[model samples]
Target chain A: MRYALRGGKRLRGFLVLESAALHGISRAAALPAAAAVEALHAYSLVHDDLPCMDDDDLRRGQPTVHVRWDEATAVLAGDALQTLAFELCCDPVLGPAERRVALVAALAKASGAEGMVLGQALDIAAESAAAPLTLEEITALQAGKTGALIGFAAEAGAILAGADRLPLRAYAEAFGLAFQIADDILDVEGDPEAAGKRLGKDAGAGKATFVSLLGLERAKARAKDLVTMAELALAPYGAAAETLRDAARFAIARQS
Target chain B: MRYALRGGKRLRGFLVLESAALHGISRAAALPAAAAVEALHAYSLVHDDLPCMDDDDLRRGQPTVHVRWDEATAVLAGDALQTLAFELCCDPVLGPAERRVALVAALAKASGAEGMVLGQALDIAAESAAAPLTLEEITALQAGKTGALIGFAAEAGAILAGADRLPLRAYAEAFGLAFQIADDILDVEGDPEAAGKRLGKDAGAGKATFVSLLGLERAKARAKDLVTMAELALAPYGAAAETLRDAARFAIARQS
Candidate 1:
């Protein structure tokens, strides 16, 4: 957890909080859900840092959980974090069954195998990936692996905010794509210093990329389009959803 | 999944089906929920078999997931089954939001850390268990680890049947304790051949046991009392819960 916080993306937290506020849910009401989401994000990184997984030695310029502790300890700590996220869902501030269950359901999608694990699975599966992946297959794989969790985080705010399913599901899809495109672009163009680690390894590995598949110009357009779609989903909530809107644009546009 | 299906006492599934049937729910309407409960049961087994976790090699005369397919796949498969339980809850086949969400909540409790994973943590923690676990502490561990899921299954049935919470919870709890006690007895005195595996390891490990803490006869009596109590919880349901009553008696008396 210490290592996880070193390179904290306060932006993600801000997006979650802002959307909840827009929805008129109080700080106390949203804190648990927000904490759970962030914890989940951290836990993903912790596991992603593992030798068999992403194999990063450092995160946020600090030794990762696996490096600081050991592989076994890192594994257990990640397991503990997953458990803690669920426990926090009992955050008494959000007592309504409708909202709580909604948050829980979204979290499951963002963090579980179908979303994050499946994504990681694909990343590893592609280590020796021979065939060129089609646009559809790449989209599906990225959606399940990287995009799904971000989609969860974005849509989670709307759910907590009491937004209906149409907007919630819509923003979820858009933000998910936006998040993936941003990460992909970063890999292609980002300075290793700015990204806090390696860059272009994906291309070196011959792994598929938005740039590789769609070209840089087209990928940039796709990211912009997704950001616009994400913002429009929040239009239903008027200004309350603006923070989420801004975050989507910043997420895709920010160089780092 | 094949190995996960082999060794369960099925006490949890029994309580769920029994309680629901008593409340006038048809078997057809109850199928999905029952399968879900079973899947949860299967999932817990799969996780419990991991190397960094229980390090167990044998289950129901078969190698565990970690032993059979490697740790990563076991982890992923467990993750998939858990989300599958939630998706099952959303099945169009399941009726009445009250029952569906309630069932989902119960299912989550069984698999999540505080319940099963926490129990496993405590059990594994015992390898270097910092403190001497009292009989009560050990019981709590088993209750949370093993009993809670079983209880969830029973409660799932009652929720589907639309039974009141008081009866639902009561029936589930009694069955949980009864189910664990039966395992304790089986471990101590039952036949390995009938039980489908070895039975003497817990004693060698010096793991907590009812026979060690409460004596064999006292534990046997306690198991019987728990069965009686489980049946009493369903007095309101009468004949509808009769199968549950039979299962409880079977649990304590089973040779395996």
Candidate 2:
């Protein structure tokens, strides 16, 4: 489980910390939520790389869980890590019971059937799709696949502080879409060495992605636009959200 | 998800509902917790049946998730069901925010590293052990893998009613152990048709089990003793606990 958690951008964790800071929630109070999101993300990656899933042998520059260990260990490790995420959310350090309950509920919603799992199911079904997915279909898929967790991470602070979550939610929505577009862009042109995993898998599969549907140049432009929207959504936070705005820009610029 | 959840004894869920009823908690109020545990159990079973895990092709006389659908679907369905369990716990109908949070925390504790997952990991490790596990080691493993969830289910009502949990906790501990012993006995002597799945698997795998260590007669005696202890723990509830006593007896006597 620890090996699986090692080496990542830690973007979702950062989102939790930064958003919590914006809401005047102490770093200590928010750290658990940050760790929780990271653990959850790690679990997803572990399972996604399974022999029966993407069947990837590499992740984050190291052998994937199933490749490093046995398949049973990989499966059990992922399961345990997921349970750990929820356990982290139950930490008393997070503050009021109501807020803690809200975090549990929100995380469950974001990561469950209506969210990440739904997106994954659609993605699997898409493999045998009669035709490539439309832009709108892909958009919806990415919303659940990537957007929900980011949304939860960004909104964690507001939930902790019992403040309005609208602004962070808007920022998360734009930022998440930009992030997915960036991933799609990476699939078109990325160094597998730096990325720490096989690149161009979408293209190899002949699957429709942002790059395939929009072309590389147009996809880059769309990503830039989404980043701008992400930044603009932070107007309510003003200077306090500068770091978050910078994160949006970094999402597009990142190579891996 | 629906297919994954079909046809099981629903013992964990039944424990929750019955325990809740003992404390005068309404069935409707407890339904989410009931459903949540059942969903969690179903998810565990689905994953356990995967090719990488127990590799079972049948469950409750029906094709296992991976056998009926595909490995990808089984994985996703199990993942989704796990998320659904936490979501169900977050149901507003569960009552005060504090209670809901408590439920989430308890369930997480029961199902995570120190609980069910730990037991599973140990079980897997035991398969490759230099020698068969001792009675003590097997006992510890079963407590985590199977007993923890039962403990949680039995105590959930007390948690909901905010009553003294010590008695129910005692009842649960004894009942859970007895339940496991009965299962070991079934492995030694059970009809595949009645049990709804393969029997003699433990002996077939040369895995250490209660019956193997204690012999059939002594294992049966131990289970009877535990059931007695389970019933004695419910003395405080008196006549209101008769149903629970019956459940304890049924655990040892049931053919399935």
Candidate 3:
């Protein structure tokens, strides 16, 4: 579990911290929430790399948990990491009881059956489907699988501050799509050496990703448009949320 | 997830409900907590039955989740069920924000690293140890793997009612050990038809258990003593706690 969490961009965690900062919540107070999201993400990745799932051999330039240890260890580690995520959310340092409870509930909703799990299930089902998923279908699946947790992270500050979550949620919804499209773009054109893992997996699987459905140029265009919309959502917060706007741009501009 | 949830004894859920009722919390209001514990249990079972884990096909007289569906489905279903457990804990019907937050925190503590997961990890590590675990070691492992969640269920009512938790916690600690001992006894002497799953797995795996360490008669006696202690812990509640007492007895006497 520690190995799985050892490295990453910490994007989701960063979103939580920046959003919390906007609400005047201290980094110390928001640390658990940030860690919780990252832990949850790591768990998902660990499970997704299992033999019965994506069966990937490498993650972050190292052997996947199942490959390095064994499938049973990977499964248990993922389960424990997930449990830890919720435990972190329950930390008293998160603030008032109401805020803590709200964070717990929101994280659950974002990660559970109706959110990330549903998206994953759909993605699996799509693999065996007679026809490939349409653009809209892929979009919806991405919304759940990738967007839900990002949405939760971006909205955490507002939730902690007892402010309206709408604008941040809007920003997250757009930002998530852009982030995934960037991933799709990476899958098509990325250097495996730079990415530190296998690339072009979607093509190998013959799965319909944004790049598959829309072609390279159009997918890039769509990602940029989503980034623009994500930035626009911060108009209400003005310069107070510039870091978040940078995060939006970073989602698209990163090479890996 | 639903399939995994079906056809179980619901022992943990029952404990939560009965404990809540004793504390003057309504069954309706407590329903989510009951369901939450059951969901968490189901998730653990589903994951434990995966090919790389326990590799069991049968559960509750039906195929296990991975056997009935696929390993990927089992993984996702377990993950979703776990998330659902936390979400259920967040239900407004659980009580005031403070009570709800307490439930979330307590449940997480009981099920996470310092509790169930740590137990499971130790159990897995025991498999490759140079020597079989001692009786004391097995006891500690079961305390985490099986006892912690049961402890949480048994204490849920007091948490909800803002009552003292010590008595129930004491009762739960004893009851959980007795319950595990009963399971070990069944593994030694149970009929597969009655048990609804394979028996003698511990012996097959060369793992130490209560029966292996204590001898059958002494183990049974230990279980009986534990039940007595569990009942004695409820002395404060007197007759009002009779249902819980019956549960303690049933844990040892049940065929399955």
Best by lDDT: 3
Model 1 chain A, TM-score vs. native: 0.91
Highest DockQ model number: 2
Residue lDDT tens for model 1, A93-205: 76565666666667776767668778777766666577867778788888887677666666666786577657756776888787788888899988777667667877887
- Better candidate number, 2 or 3, judged by lDDT: 3
Name every residue pair that clashes in candidate 1.
A119-A145, B22-B240
* Share of the reference A-B contacts seen in candidate 2: 0.83
Q: Which residue pairs collide, candidate 2? A: none
Scoring each candidate complex against the real one, what DockQ results? 0.21, 0.85, 0.82
Per-residue lDDT for B24-108 in model 1, tens only?
6766677777767776667667766666555678776777777777666666666555555565564545566556666666666
Instruction: Tell me the alpha-carbon RMSD of every candidate.
Output: 4.3, 1.1, 1.1
B40 in model 3: Cα distance from truth in Å? Answer: 0.4
Q: Single out the weakest 10-residue window by summed lDDT for candidate 3 chain B.
A: B112-121
TM match of model 2 to true structure: 0.98
After TM-score superposition, what is the CA distance of residue B231 in candidate 2 from its true location, in Å?
0.8
Interface RMSD of 2: 0.8
* Candidate 2 residue B222 C-alpha distance from true site, Å: 0.9
lDDT of 1 at A137: 77
lDDT by residue (A1-256, candidate 2, tens digit) is 9999999899999999999999888899899999999999999999989988889999999999999999999988898888889889989999988999899988998998888888888888889999999999999999988899999999999989889999889989999999999999888788899899999899999998988999999999999999999999999989999999999999999988
